[model samples]
Target chain A: MKTLSLRNLQKTYFDPYAGSQVTAVHDVSLDVEQGEFVSVVGPSGCGKTTILNMVAGFIPYSGGEILLDGAAVKGPGPDRGVVFQSFALFPWKTVLENVGFGPKMRGVPKADRDRIAREYLELAGLSHAADRYPNELSGGMQQRVGVVRALANNPAVLLMDEPFASVDAQTRMTLQEELTRIWQERKPTVIFITHDVAEAVFLANRVVVLSKGRVLDQIKVDLPRPRVWDHLMQDETFKRLSAQVLQMVRSA
Target chain B: MIASGQRTGSKTPGSGWVWRTMNSLAGAAVFVAPLLALVAIWAIVVPLFEVNPRIFPSVASVADAAADSIRDGSLIRHIGASLLRVGLGTLIGVVTAVPLGIAMGVSPAVSSFLTPLFRFFSVLAGIAWIPIATLWFGYGFGAIVFVIFNAVFFVVAYNTLLGVSTIPMTIRNAAASLGARRWALLTEVLLPGALPNIVTGVRTGLGFAWRGLIAAEMIATNVGLGYMLFVARDFYRTEVIVLGMIVIGLLWLLIDRLLLVPLERATIERWGLVRRT
Candidate 1:
């Protein structure tokens, strides 16, 4: 069953001074099945973020609709957790507090919320830094906190917007592995957006390439689990898949 | 390597104690330099001109007046009176201003319409309020404190509104997506995000209030630093007037440096989101 669906989503911004209108996203439609890890790759300003924002209910669409689990997305809710590109962790909050934020908002018991937040922190491999402020942590560690914060609520779908784009190369590789492990364990439908082709290929079960606010192609990655970066990069099949994604992103 | 050495030095046992002692001395020297220079200039110029002791006194004479006031305990009474008024006024202003500002700033349309109103009122807060405050409260501590309260309130409210409005939409959206309710969003995201600006506003407002307090005291009050200066002016006691001026300057410097600067630094250190170069 499809966990999420977008039907002919359209977005336009009016320029009063210019006496004209600009179409940001035009007639875009896509669907994601249950437990699917889908990556959306596109060029800059191609409305990839707009699509994600619409699904997250951050902005209203001019036309069409977004349905999550057979219901229209009215506004931002706990059922769809979003991890932003900038790792927007509250500066005043420690790692544990940030992670527990969702549960606390839901009026969960203090002990239960703390326990769940601790588990998510450990899952993100940030147990040692749970008491530290976001500024005290590295960029990768901050992103980990963002992810844990989102996941603490046990959302039905996890939305990631270039989650690893700001991290160092080595940290990015490690995070990808950790993400894949967490995805397998939790089994939430994931929609990851990135400009990096290799990232799309490595972590996604299926890759959806978008261009000019339209879905260009959807390819299934039938590879095995527990993927290792070093060995996988050497494989001819991995290279071929990366080349295809690269071609789509470049042309877009 | 230098960075490592600095880090190690910062962390070494007993180093913090030594560093804090040195830091305080450095801070005090920075504060005291200008006052010392001003005093030296006064000493040189007064003697050079052989100025009338009625209009302006010699540095030695001003020092003697200061000692006399201190010994008589009038200096303590004046200082205490002024401090009490300022404390009460600031407390009332801050408690009122912060909430009103946040309420106004929460909505875009409301905030835009009200911003100009706040700007106009803030401009008229301090010195302009003196005549009306004196009319309403009559000549005494009440009138003087009213002026100080008016000075702090509008400025703090204006700055708090700006602070709340300037928070990035992305941060708010991020918090919302992470399941923050209205109350949670306000407390966690809005308040901390606006803290640096609020602290800055408080500092600026207090500066205006301090000045307004002096001006009000001169006009309305029977006892205070400004009253002391005014009384000295009437009696042609130039030495006493000079002493009062020095005391005012020193007191303000102490409040700004010792109290406000550290408070601002601690807040920014704790809740500031932006990285400093």
Candidate 2:
């Protein structure tokens, strides 16, 4: 069964200043099976993030239905976790506290939540910086905290919106590797959104190319598992897949 | 950064309480030194110029009056009375203002409709209320306290409204998506997020309240610092008036430096995220 499926989803935003209705996502439909990684890649302003936000339940859709395991999504719940592009870690909280916030909200005991947070922080290689404030950490470290904070919720679906867009290239590569390793172990249904073709190809099993407000094509990435940067960067298949995604995005 | 480092430096492992005490004492000396120097200059200038006692009391005469007031316990009585009025008024103002402000702020239509009204009232706070207060409550503690209360309420409410309303929608959405309920959202997200602004409101409100208290005391009350100053004006007793002025100045400095300033600084530190360069 599909963990997440969108049927002809649409969103129309009323631009009050412009005095007109603008459609952000038009007839976009897609699905992700349980434990699958799907990356949605497109040019800027292609409504990819809008789709992610709707799935995360941060925004309302004008039409269509989003089903999770045959159940309709009512509103934002603990069932779907989201990693924001801006790394929206609460400034007042420490690394441990921010990571544990989800479990705490779910009424988990302090000791248990702390243990869960510590384990996830360990997975992100941030166990040593658990007590530090968000502002005191590097951008990469803060994003790592953001990822674990979402993961600690144990949501059935994980939505990532260009989670590494703000970091330096080297840090982005490192975070991608860290995320891939963690995702391999957990194997949650993930819908990752990005504009970078190489990044989308590297982390996803399937790449959905979006343009303007619709999906242009969905390409299956048959790259080998436990994908290594050195090997993947030089592999012919990786080059071909990335080139195809880049061409589609450019044309769209 | 350097100042915060010094403030937190005393928390070093194995640092004794005595060392921390000495460190704060040194910090206090920086403020005290200038006041002492001003007093020395006053003492020298007054006698050197042979200034008239009626116009400005000499340092010795002011000192004598201060000692006499203290010995007679009138100084403490007047100070205690004024402080009690401000305390009661401010307590009522803050308790009522915070919740009402948050409620109004939660709704956009109500908040926008009330913003101008709040701004108008806050601008007219303090002494403007004194006449009506005295007329409504009679000339006494009730009138004086009413004036202080009016002074604090409008400013605090307006600021709190602004604080709560200015919170980014993104943060609220983030909390909701993370499974926060209404109560949790208010207590954990809204309150903490608005605290820095609330503290700023308190500081500003208290400033207005302090000024209003003195003005109200002069007009309505019979036994406070402003009353003491006004009564001394009739007898040309410059020493008592000067003593009252000094006491008022010192009290405000003590309250702000010890209470409001620290509160503001702590909230700013707790909520103010310093952006990375």
Chain A TM-score of model 2 versus the true structure?
0.98
DockQ of each: 0.48, 0.49
Put down candidate 2 lDDT per residue, B138-236, tens digits, no spaces.
999998888888878888888888878877876676677778888988887777777766777887889999999988899898998989999999999
Per-model TM-score on C-alpha atoms: 0.90, 0.94
| Candidate 2 lDDT, A1-252, residue by residue in tens | 689999999999998988999998999999899999999999999999989889888888999989998998877888888888888887767788888988989999999999999999999999878877787788999999988888899989989999999999999999998888888999988999999999999999999999989999999998888887878999999999999999999999
After superposition, which runs of candidate 2 have C-alpha atoms over 4 Å from their true positions?
Answer: B1-12, B16-23, B274-277
lDDT of each: 0.86, 0.87
First chain TM-score for all predictions: 0.96, 0.98
- Residue B150, candidate 2: C-alpha displacement in angstroms: 2.0
Could you give the fnat of all candidates in order?
0.62, 0.44
Cα error of candidate 2 at position A122, Å: 1.7
Candidate No. with top lDDT: 2
Worst 10 residues of 1 chain B by lDDT: B1-10
Measure candidate 1: CA RMSD. 3.5
For candidate 2, list the clashing residue pairs, or say none.
Answer: none
